[model samples]
Target: MAKSKLSEKEQVTEYIQKLDPSLAETITFLRQAILAIDGEISEHIKWNSPSFYYSGDMKPFNPKEYKRDILVMNLHRGTTILLVFPTGAKITDTSGLLEGNYPDGRKIAKIKDLDEAKSRQKDLENAIRNWMGQIEK
Candidate 1:
């Protein structure tokens, strides 16, 4: 079957749909989580992939820019950091999740399943909060 050429938003929605059906709920949950953290959050297409960014901010958060394999969330603040998946997952510091590989020899955590994705969500949120706090400090 030929894959339809999707706009950036359609592509992202389609990617989420292709995940385990159960993950559909997780994707919505994550979107809400991101929005709740910052009301200024907005969506856009970057590098032919879906990305989230803050209003007035020059950078967008994209978790799929490494070798273009694992999905990643890039948060830019005072210190720009990339939150990669399980094998490339940098937040957990543990294994058992999805493995991530970077084109540049950088390893990230792979988000194996919905559960792992949720855990990563928490970590990402915490990191965002910490980053904001640092700016205030």
Candidate 2:
């Protein structure tokens, strides 16, 4: 069968569907919540994972700038899912949920499942919003 062209979100959803059930559920929840944050947020497959980009006034992401501004999820290791900020944007984390204290300013929020994701949803969205502002500048 010829593979039909799929929208980016569809492509990502397809990728998520292949994951272990628990991980898939967590990623799905995160994807929906992140997209709900802003209408301008767009996503695509980057580094073999679902990556989100904010295209406010700036030009949409080019291949060269793939790492410049992105919110990506890492699910390669195991049941634990990682929300990674590759560009090292300084995001607000009043809840102190984000880890990775690298000097480069990169950070990540580790999420285990739907419940944990729900608990940290507000913090994650706030951090993402702050990160978006950082990239806009």
Q: Write the residue-wise lDDT of candidate 2 on 28-106 in tens digits.
A: 8999999999888988888899989876676455655444555788888787888888654466677887788876667
lDDT of each: 0.47, 0.80
Error of 1 at 131 (Å): 3.9
Give the distance in Å from residue 35's predicted Cα in candidate 1 to where it truly belongs.
1.9
TM-score, one value per model: 0.45, 0.85
Badly placed stretches (over 4 Å) of model 1 are 1-20, 57-109, 132-137
Global CA lDDT computed for model 2: 0.80
Instruction: Please give me the total number of clashing residue pairs in predicted model 2.
Output: 0
lDDT of 2 at 52: 90
Q: Please report how far candidate 2 places residue 3 from its true position, in Å.
A: 3.6
- Candidate 1 lDDT by residue in tens digits, 2-108: 97777755766776676556655655566566657766555545544345554433333354433222234443222222334322333333333333455544443
